[model samples]
Target: MNENKKTLGELLNASYSAFGYAIGFSCLVNLLMLTAPIYMLQVFDRVLPSQSSDTLVYLTIIAILAIIVYGILDIARAQVLTRVSWWIDNKLSPIALAKSLDHTLLGGSYAAQSLADITTLRQFLSSPSIYAFFDAPWIIIFLIVIFLLSFPLGIIATLGAIVLLSLAILNEKVSRKPLEQANTLHMNNQESISNSIRQAECIQAMGMMSPIVSKWLHNNEAVLAMQCTASDRSGIVLSFSKSIRLILQILILGVGAYYVINGELTSGAMLAASIIMGRALAPAEQAIGAWKQAINALQAYRRLQHYLSQPETRPPEILLPKPQGRIDVNNLLYIPAGAKKPVIQGVQFTLMPGESLGIIGPSGSGKSTLARLLVGIWPPTNGTVRLDGANIYTWNRQDIGNHVGYLPQDTLLFKGSVKENIARMDKIEDAKIISAAQFVGVHDMILHLSHGYDTDTSRYHLSGGQAQRIALARAFYGSPALVVLDEPESNLDQEGLAALELIYKNAQKSGITIIVVSQRPMLMKHCNKVLVMRDGHMERFGLYAEIIR
Candidate 1:
């Protein structure tokens, strides 16, 4: 029940033509449903009184035809609604994902919330929450029709419905606070459970099973107590409202019966009036349910809106074409949040085209940050990263991606064949694929696989070092102008490290600019120069011997 910053009207406005058509179809279905009861009353009051057998037969045939038509319309309406929901889900998912990625790259604190909010929003979109829009409008229309048919009776019924709705709203207001508390407790309990599972091995090793289990149970009990209390409050209110509505219905029926007996109204008219009252009241009850669902949907929408509002780390821009890769950081400055001083303050460096530079530093130094800045993962607080005298940020994201290749310490491989993982399903010839794998020292491993390059990596996996090599192969697959590797030899043994050194030599030989961040002295030996960093600032830049000394 949080106040929605973006209203339902705004959402509808943002929706495409298909959404409008779906709503129109749903309304037509409701119109057909309303007609069925009216048609029934016509047959009972007018057609039957004529006492013509043929007329009765024709009326019955028409009613049956209307029923069939209504059924078909209902089916089509459901189909359209389903499709609309799917379309919204599909369109919104990518936008949500992109926003989350942008926030993460920007070092936004709410990145995790962005992911959770997107998931909840998608669920709301696909659930009964959206259908409530169709139902609520139809219910209002039904109530209006009933009011027109019988003034006094409709007024009485309307009063009863208003009372019921008011009570429901009051109940919602009273229960929402407790429901929120219960939900908070539930989330805390879930987090505790997840942490317990993730640290099961450590817990067992420390023999703290009893303490962990006791804590988990305590949290679970607290969550359960909160949930039960909330549920009881909601149930009591709903039961009371339902009872009042039932009493109102009985009173209306009794009044109608008395009027019929006193000859103030005909028997058929009384029956029709009772039927209309029920139809109108039924929609009111449905509307209450829809209102509850709307609250949840609105909450989900608000969460998504918060995610979408986060600032982008690297705004999308178009970069001018460069003939060669010449990286220059002019008075680079990076100040992480809550830090007193900027990392890499007033740092400046320039690398000519095809120059291979190595960055070496202790842990927690600015080596990785500098590498990230060079790759455009983070923008400097002050200063600029330029390629061929033009700011890299000015380039289109896709263009930067095509020109620069980055390999992080933790390489993630998707579930696919080696060929698909390496080639990325591009139309690369086998010879090129083999050459790239060979250049990265993974060619022999691929040859040994059951299907060679076609082997399903998802079924049979590679070790960490092998995976890193494959990742390296993929990064260098397109022969990007600038290749940045962070801790390339961290997981590799001596043999693998030797293989990587050869790969680096070959890359430099091919006139591709290479920048590597590593702690290993052996890797730095092959570089022409080494850049040393400490505490987010560059300390030295010189030959490997000079820096080591």
Candidate 2:
């Protein structure tokens, strides 16, 4: 909401302009608060004493108009609060989503919790409970009005308001920590369930479904216990606040009657004092009951603030002009996630356009790690991976992606059509999709499916080799300047192997740079050069024929 700065408060305050209007409306509504008691007083004192029918008629009509206006103002303020909630949803949800995405990329679960926090804040803003706090300050105004009517009445109302205020404060103190603890337990419970669902297939394969379910239930029960404890305490506080408010109203009425009997007050004044005293305590009682929601909203606001305090990630910068597919890796090293030792240690290589390189290494030799580094998936620990003399890591990633193709060892596909999968979910152009599929020799395989290119891949199961080839088509969807494939033929049969060779032959002729990592020596035969890695260190780098010799 601020041009030179941004914070959760600023974004939330952007909606308070509506509250500004609502507060102005609230002033009129509070003035209208005088309607009921004053209406009763006029009927009792003025109409009965004067006994003029016309005076009675005029007063009744005027009171009706005041009540109607009060109703309208109250409705307008509620609508304004509703609009404030809408503003928060529309404005903050996207920012929260982006921040959540950053967390997801850094190995955190998808930012569902962050979005949930925003939703909690939005609901609190829109709920009627929020109006309790908004109306709270007016309690003093009503007490002051009562003071003007009679000093004794004012003193009684003041003591009642103080008692209600004290109860509200006590409610906050008693409930705050338990509510926060319940919320934390609830989050942990949800996360445990999410983990079970995400890895359900593994659990099923391992025959551990029952145990996982029992574990989830056990965690959830803990949350329920915490919630029950919090609810019990809050319920007691709410009951006490309500009882005190009703008792105070009766006490004010008794005092007002006593004053009237002593010739210090009139009958209407006695009734009005009781009316205003009830009105004065109503907001505090409401506030005491609404403290739970206030605590929840406050916690949510703090979480959002903590999320925003993390380093912000901005959109990609300018994309470099299309380059000639040259890759420069200088003193590259990488320490993988949750590991202390570097996975690729001081390994560097460069491949010119139209050249093909093969990386052959035993298991745990960092071949896949190097492939990942070359494609800009992981930043190197020590040096740079430059594509066309600019660091690809800092490039406008989506634009640079147009010229880069990558096939990680483990393939992935979202739920979509076969054509969509082949095109990486881009606009499905028939020729492009089929050409990529044909290059990987999955064209005929896809056509044989129940709906061919339009088939929903989620409902359609592909064998290991079939899935691998389809993923290959995806990596080749666009005309990429650099192609890095890790274990491309891991699941492929003899026919699949030939198709991969043809794909590489095409890349060799088209001046596209290629890097392939494989365990099979047959797959590395066509490479003009070879690199051998062992235990994160490059053992050999030279012409393929010479290295073999």
Candidate 3:
């Protein structure tokens, strides 16, 4: 708890009124819980001894009304708890999703598990077993009434409570370690299964399914063994608690009978004492029975608290004006998410608005890193990449993305119509979509499809070259001021290459800046300047004619 920066209790306290109301309902319900034994006591002691039909009728009527009100209170409490859980879910679901995505982008664990944790907490809130925790304090309340009957009875009930409570604590201590181990084992197995499914094609081609299955089973068996250990340990305590409760309850009657024979208690008082003692011990017994679930709930709560403690990435302080495609890098450097040394070090360059630069490098020469930095996909390790005089990383990414275009080596389309993909899923414009497609020479190919622009392109059903052309069309959409294409023609054929050249001519005429990262020099013919990189540093940067010479 000292190590935790935020806690489940704090999150619950944020919804103070809802929790307060639920607790209020619990108090009311527990107060009403006293109704049953009291009603039985009155019938056995007062009404029957009085021998008046009217007295019996009146007492019975009052008891029935009290029981009805008790039922109502229980129902109301359940509804309140359910709503509180709903309010929590509605409030935290979106925030958790956004936080999870941001963390993932920064190389943190996936937050989807937090959603599952929240559901587990919601179940804990609504489960009938949960009411035991709330009712626990009322054991003293019940014991006080027992004391009013006889000192001996009060002592017996107190001892019973202590014993049951001890069993609950024992249950927790016995199961905690194994339960924690089981949870860890479960997570490892889940990750293994997810990885196997994701790489199923590779596994199939390599015929490694049998070996993977054996590894998965080994992980699963460890989890199962821990689960069995926890269950066995908790089962012993749970069974012992139930046994003690029954024995003490039955002995309460015997003790009460002994007192009754000595005129210390009445027959009615003896029966009432036994019933009240069971009522008091029932809660602890229920808790003992569910100790394993309680441990899981505790783990889930801590996981969520740790996740919530992580600071969220803030949005831009204020929206900035649109930037022209003038890029300036000063002593720029980059290191991957988890690495010891920089991948690009002390590299610097500048490109004026409307300038076209071609980036050529050997494999692992940091060309892709340079392109990503220029587009503000990531922040630099040191120094900065500025666009139009302000640091590009300081600007709002969503706002700045409006003016940037990129074609990554890997092109992925969402489950949407061709027009939507071209428009980057923003509001559709017929002219912009058609013009971009025509710019990439995919317009005729699109029209030939059955649904033309409205076709659902979930699977990239077209040929590889055709898919690359569509991706190129997307990059050219809206005539973004700066276009960065990282190996854009890797999958394009001669016709697609011609379309690429046409886009360059058209973009050059329109004065849009372009940066193309490629290994092959086929498209360098269209570049006026070239930058060469070798071993994470700039090797040469000059006019195309000079560099070629």
**What lDDT is reached at residue 488 by model 3?**
84
List candidate 1 stretches off by more than 4 Å: 1-19, 47-50, 109-132, 137-152, 178-230, 290-292, 309-311, 424-432
Q: Which candidate wins on lDDT?
A: 2
lDDT of 1 by residue, 1-549 (tens): 121224333444666566676677667766666655666567666777877778768767877787788788766666665666665566666666665675667655454454555455556555554654565555566667655655655666778767767766776686666666665566667766776887887999999999988998898888778767766766776677777778777766677677667866555555565665666566445545444345545565676676555444555455567437788989999897677777667668888778888898898887888888888777778899887777776566766766787788667676887877777566767776777788778888778878888877778767788778777888777667888899888668777888888978887787778899998766787777788888777789977678765
lDDT of 1 at 375: 80
- lDDT of candidates 1 onward, in order: 0.70, 0.83, 0.82
- In model 2, which regions exceed 4 Å deviation? 1-13, 108-112, 313-316, 336-339, 419-435, 459-468, 490-498, 526-528, 546-549
- In TM-score terms, candidate 1 sits at 0.86
Structure candidate 1, residue pairs in collision:
318-394, 319-394, 319-395, 344-536
Cα lDDT of model 3 by residue, 77-172, tens digit: 888888887777776666677677656656665465778777877787777767888788888988998998878889989999999999889888
lDDT of 2 at 420: 90
Clashing pairs in 3: none
